[model samples]
Target: MTVISVHVPKTGGSSFLDILRKNYGAKLLVDYGLEATTALAAMTSGEHEIVHGHFVADKYVDVQGARYITWLRDPIQRLFSHYQFWQRNKFPRSPFWRQQYYNNFTFEEFAFSPAVRNEQARYLGGMDIKTFSCIGITEFFVESMELFSKSLGMDIELDNLPQHRVNTLSKKGYELDDKGLRAALYEFHSLDYQLYIQGLEVFKSQYSQVSGCLDTRFWDLQKSSQKSFPPQFSLQKLLAEKQVSNVIGTYYYGDGWPINMWDTFRRDVVDEYLDEVRSDGFNTIILLFPMSLFKLKSSNQKAHEIFYNDLVFLLDKIRDKGLNFMFRLGYSWDGFPLSGDRGRVAFSVLCEGSSKDEFIEEARQLYLIAETYSEFLYGFITWEDLLMFPCNRAPKASEPMRIQLATELGFTGNSGAIPERDSGEFLGYLEFLDIKFTDLFMDLAVAFPRLSAEVRVDTTPYNDSDGGEHHYVHHRQFVETDCDVIGTYFATYMLPEKPTLNDMKRILSFVHRQLQVSDPSKKIFIDQLLLVIDESIGKGYSTISEKVIDAFVKWFPEWLDANSIGYATWAFCDYVWDVIFNGTFRYGPLGWEFGGNTMLVESAETRYVQMESGAWLRGGRILHFEPWPQRGCIQIELEVDDACSITVELSDSYTVELDKRDMSQVSSGKRQVITTEFEIVPEYLKILINGGAAKIYRVGLGKEISSCGGRDLNMNHRVTSRLIRELNNNYGGNC
Candidate 1:
């Protein structure tokens, strides 16, 4: 029974999502609560049997072997509901309200802005959405839900309808007086008011108020088949435990990019030891190649070819072992597969006013790479800012004419261009530049497929009513509450002052939770991705501390889920050679130092991992041995049954009930931490013992977990990100 519901927010769409969850179990779909609207809805297609969530267009509505259904609210009422939602949330710096911290809206000023007036009017008119099959008003939410059930030859009970899916801020945060809020709601929600009136009129002529023609009570059958599911932590543990291997392999490095001149770009030599890369069953590699963006220079430049060739050579070897590759595509900037042409580097500025053709030509060059290489490519990255600005309702299709034009050239645009912005501190003096980047890019997505980017932020540096500066006073309450930079680009809030072991654990956890998906094929991509991050980021910054570095290395399986984020990395050492590299586990002495005899050893790869405050600590060497005869089993303890809880932080997707026990598993003994059981069959493809060095690549844990110290990720070596350096430094270590 495949269920696909194309959800359009506001028209009580969540009511249906809630119902489906109650019946089918919440794990049936990705958890929207832990993610932003973009990532929450990423990769979900309307075509799936029961894939439903704010799917506004048909392109996103396609389902394979499933039902196709949708519900819509009266246009005007939907518009007003949208308006009220913004009003309820008090538009964060919306032009109509206040871009400033104070409630500085002049009634007249609020009444004039396009987001407030024209856009609202378009919404209220119901003129924007025309493709919905069952259109009704919120007043008839129960009936509409009934119609939805009947459309699919089923029955439902409306009693379990979730009240207000979006949990909004408290009254104190909105900063609105009761009276003022009432006024704003009344004025903005006018469409709902009028539409209700009109809908009432229509209902009178169509059917009695409650004639019992349909089963409203039966709708409870739709009570999320998955509500109140088990915690995903168990599944997370299971996954981490299953991804065992002594090697930290690299993906897309070795491409001899000039920027990587400082590290050991030896992924090319990794081919001599596939057994080592496949060590401990955690076989990983970072593909080293580039999109056509810099094809001209990459092909022509000697140094660039050397690095890229090395990366490709690694890929060919990894594939030879019949292993899948997780290809992470870097965007206009952000150096993963280094570019020979510096002009192509990230944060690149394109003409905000470029014509459709110009944008398409360039965009086409990029999009084709993703489309053409979809098979080997496990994830098609939307952006690399890794920095996202948290704001609801990014520029709609009608906006960003130029960027929209770029999308018309054929590529989906995303609203993740800008990173999270704080209320007081500006984005330096580049606010204008940020705006330009978003304005032009989003416009392109509208015209093309979808545009995406990244975001980063920490909830520190804030003020209270008391207004006493408590800079780093060591307050857990403050870390969890006060001074937090809400609306973080990814709603990311780090609690680090300097890189720490806990920070890496936090980031690892964050990425896994946000990247959960229901497909096994997707898991294959995730398995490959882990190998990538270990390489790129791990290799790029090699001078950091061991605690931070080890923590990152120890708990790397955290962020692996996602909404279409593939991964890869650059350079790495020999897998067999590095497995036994960490002989004594010295912070400074650890890491794949330039010249070392990579050998397999039994060790935990020594890094700090978070535990339940009083959880028993079995301190000893955690020997990473091999990938399961199967794929995607993290090197940790996990349960796979009835109701499973799991987190894939890289994609920021979390799930409570994951009974799917086919793909992975883990095991441990008094001292033997070996990964032999796999969620695979035939038992022939598991990781085997081999003598070789490991490789490196860049795969992101679909999350933004932080170090206990809450250090910044951008800086080279605060203990927080020292794991990256440590991994790179000891490019020849093994578990």
Candidate 2:
């Protein structure tokens, strides 16, 4: 029982194919390209319930008891759409002659071309119009599909049979307003116009005969299938039965920072770093590795070996520090060119379509390495490195990628048809990438059971040919991966400018909901919690004030605890390359000294001052100016009792007092901001905090005074690290 569907170009066949696929599933064979006929000849009857693609009707006429079907459109409109589609999308499989004709000829020239004059009729070939079991009119696509479904006893629901539009043109049709051109096109496509009219007549006749038949078949199929279908696996139930370990983690790239840290591999530095992280109450450490380190290129072989050894050493050190470790196996930018030729080679390989195999093989090697230290290994994470190109490129499917995608979409024959950007098929292409990514994760998960699959949280916006835009978020990876944990990044772009506590909460809540919608059972881990954003480091980042930083540190952890979610700072320590602002107090309290009755209280969060009425905290080197020096003002954030007053003195030249009138009520205490002027200097600036009983949280200096406090550019890292540590102590459970 073979159904041959001849999918003539620009005849609404692509959309129709989706419905057929849903109805027939694996039984539908997409026979595309010139080789389709030969491929079909080799297949036996009943092997495929439906054979659909771009082949002439006569090609399948010999099939025993086969039913032929096709859709036809207005010849002039179809020609115009086909031309527009070709202009937008490159079809490598298109015949060279056809490509040349379309590339060189005008719309009028193409419409009058003899080779494509009667495309619809030519596709039907020697087959008679009345011979088609079902001739669908593209104009009435929904009704035609319904009729075709009923004629074949396919049980397709009428309500579900919506018209699927693909490769749509901006213009509705050829310039029919040009009467002379329209008349010329109509005359040239007389045979196609006649074929389309005849097809429409056949469609109307079939639809009339079946329109009265109650659509009970679909309901009947649904009822029977429901009984036979197996129960779906419930992730929620699995999660309810198991205890999810809360992860309080930070990413470690070693002392060299960012790229090629293994190059300067120092056991003492890493050991001390891991010890500091462990002492700070971090239970987990995610090691960041550049993909370039694992490339099999001869030039990088020695570096690869060294990296492997360094990784093992770090694992041993992490185990000694009693910290759990996870591997993040792909950071594409290793500061290429500036870093060295090694990064350049790796970047090139990642961009190439042929390097997918190498990428997978390298990942397998990483798994092997982790397997050796499984005692400390929590799982592996992929850092937006699943695709050939980095996320910034907005990569399209290359020819090889499309060929693989053809197989993924269940196409049986090679087809050179590339989907137009923003078309439904193009969306499918993005989904196909997600599937490939999940497949890779699944492969690794088999060996390491506790994998965390990272979801691409950023939505890609695309404008259709009609000047309409839509955004797409890839969630297929979250939905398909069997891993128990899902990973995502929280960056500045996700928040509003000068965000408040409510804004951060709203954004995080939205992200969480989006992931939960995909799969409710999987626990989410904020693998890269980007607390401090530098606009100069990355594009489209928003700056936050010290007040926002203070609020985030206090509230974000509590929110995570209430929700049973976990997170890791993106950069536990500042990177050498200054790619991102540091997210830790790694440098400690560098240049400050306490005096009088002021007592410095040090904890896992931060080092702050507890002062008495006569206490004073003075610092000769309160702020350092690098590269050059300039005049500026100093701002400080402090908390005190309602009646308390604090005086800020800068080099004994300027002074400001913050009293109960200046303070605002907050959850912690009455908070106040104090700002004072300073003079230009080539050395560190001096400042003093004296007078009333108060607690100082932050001190900062900058050229101008705004509402925002200007702390050390890296102080946000201290706030971030402190919050993470606090979260870990309060909620992190043993895995």
TM-score for each model: 0.30, 0.45
Per-residue lDDT of 285-321 in model 2, one digit per residue for the tens? 8876666544434444544555566678788888777
- lDDT by residue (1-735, candidate 1, tens digit) is 455455555656666666766655543564333244443354353322345554333333333343444443443334445645656676555554454226554443444334544332333235323323334434456566555555554446656554442222111122323545444554664554344433333332232222322222211111111111121122223324544222233443321222221123444344434553444232455332233234324333543444345445655566676444443333332232232332223323233222323443444444444333322322223222211211211222234542443342221223313222322222321233333333333334433332322322223434322553322211111112111111112211232334456654564345433332222222222222222222223322223244444555544433322221222222232111111111121111222222232232222242222222112211111122243122232222222222222221111132211113421332211211112122321211111112211211111110111311111133333332234344433343332
Worst 10 residues of 1 by lDDT: 696-705
RMSD of each: 26.3, 23.2
What TM value does model 1 have? 0.30
Once model 1 is optimally superposed onto the true structure by TM-score, how far is the C-alpha of residue 730 displaced, in angstroms? 19
lDDT of 2 at 323: 72
Q: Number of the top candidate by TM-score?
A: 2
Instruction: Report how far residue 248 has shifted in candidate 1, in Å.
Output: 8.7
